[model samples]
Target: MKNDLERAFEEARRRDAIELEWLGASIQGRPTFAEAELLDRRGIPSCHVWKIPRNEAPVHLTAIDALRRWQAGACAMCSASPRRLLVDHCHRTGLVRGLLCTSCNTAEGLQSAPSFVAYRERPPAVILGVEEMYGSPWGEEIAPSDASPEERTQRNAAHVDAAEGLFAGITDRFRPECADG
Candidate 1:
């Protein structure tokens, strides 16, 4: 297990360095620039992200931490990764909450902008915060919610599009095999 510990330490260092790099990049164009300055201003320690619920801080890296959270049955959104996760937040409010990966968080951002015509349209469920059987970060069952007819219709349309794409890809992948049949 010593080797495993060594690997974990190395990975932690790498993640820390990379996170710092990203932090630097994010603040580079701002008035005050410098990675160390950003981290100091944000009060980020070496181990975890800081100050925001969805800002990817408080990421669990060690197997022990992951195992403990899993044992306790954590929310799936948080369990999807091990190294670290970038949580998202409400940019308008700037509240230190909205834990999600970079994508989900960004999707929220893209979806949240009211001034942007494209993002102004939001799904009813997201606007309502209605809980439903949506996939969690961890591989656990989530009971979504009852949707309105319109929402159901939209969901069906999306499913159909996705299934069609999947089938097309599969058919393309197996075209040579199909020639024999």
Candidate 2:
């Protein structure tokens, strides 16, 4: 039997094909060079492609579906518009991490791969709250731009603690043992 992730990948590919095919068809007869280039570059197979570190590249549909359900079509990194988002995965394990916009994806690619992998493995619970503000604890006034270094550090530490608490809550409630009760 196929595993849950495999099943999700299959279902997402089937659904995303329709959208991709539409994109392909829309550029079929355009005279602009950009349009034709888009068609040639994307084709059908490449349009939804998500490359892993390995030779096999997965389609973008599964990650897209997960994001749609969990994040209301917002980019995980910047919470920007969901347009042209791509799947971010671990190259070593090919694990689907999250949906990121092109810029965010590039930014992430520059960071340490292990950090991204760790974040993806046990995603923070705050990720579930897409509408909530993500970043530092001090929203606007806690630390002004000119705040002393010590003040900023304190605020950052507090934010980290709060984030850890949120993740702990999610892990405690959703752990396998807890689920059986």
Candidate 3:
């Protein structure tokens, strides 16, 4: 009974051969060429062509499924095979702490906390209204000039204030509850 299901899963994986990673960002997205090469060299075992993680890696599931799993508060660390069941960072940062199991994260922590920490902290975390941010999606953008310190500080302050105002009014845009009563 189970063998047939396992066989089918493997067959599907083989069919999806072009993509080595389906669950998260591809190797190219790793911070630097050195980083990508490092991950490649280390050999991400669970992402092997033939073997699937013992407990399924929820890479391709729809939002509803992911949400359900998240709301249920499933253990961030794998309950079954701790090593394979790591809570992989969606962004591989400490602040985001989205996917991986506890053990894998701890293992990586020994290597460098910043790399892991960056995963948990979402990029462009600054919320400027529901639609826009003062900073670009990648965060800080250099204007390509050696502007004076005073000028730079003033520009930054204005940007931050604009972003705050944008986000602040976001709540009002969605639910205008104050007027009813």
Per-candidate TM vs. native?
0.23, 0.31, 0.22
Badly placed stretches (over 4 Å) of model 2 are 1-64, 112-121, 124-181
Model 3 spans > 4 angstroms off: 1-113, 116-144, 171-181
lDDT of 2 by residue, 29-135 (tens): 22333442343244311112211122111244343353443443445544455467666654323235566668657867685544344345443222322111122
Q: What's the lDDT of the predicted structure labeled candidate 1?
A: 0.36
How do the residues 59-92 of candidate 3 rate in per-residue lDDT, one tens digit apiece?
A: 5543333322331232222222232333332221
Considering summed lDDT, which 10 consecutive residues are worst modelled in model 3? 124-133
Better candidate number, 1 or 2, judged by TM-score: 2
- Candidate 1 lDDT, 1-181, residue by residue in tens: 4798899999889877754543343322222224423443453211122211112322433322322222122111222233444433222222123234454345445543322222123221122222224332444322223555566456545655666796886777677866654
What lDDT does candidate 2 reach at residue 32?
36
Backbone clashes in candidate 2 total 0
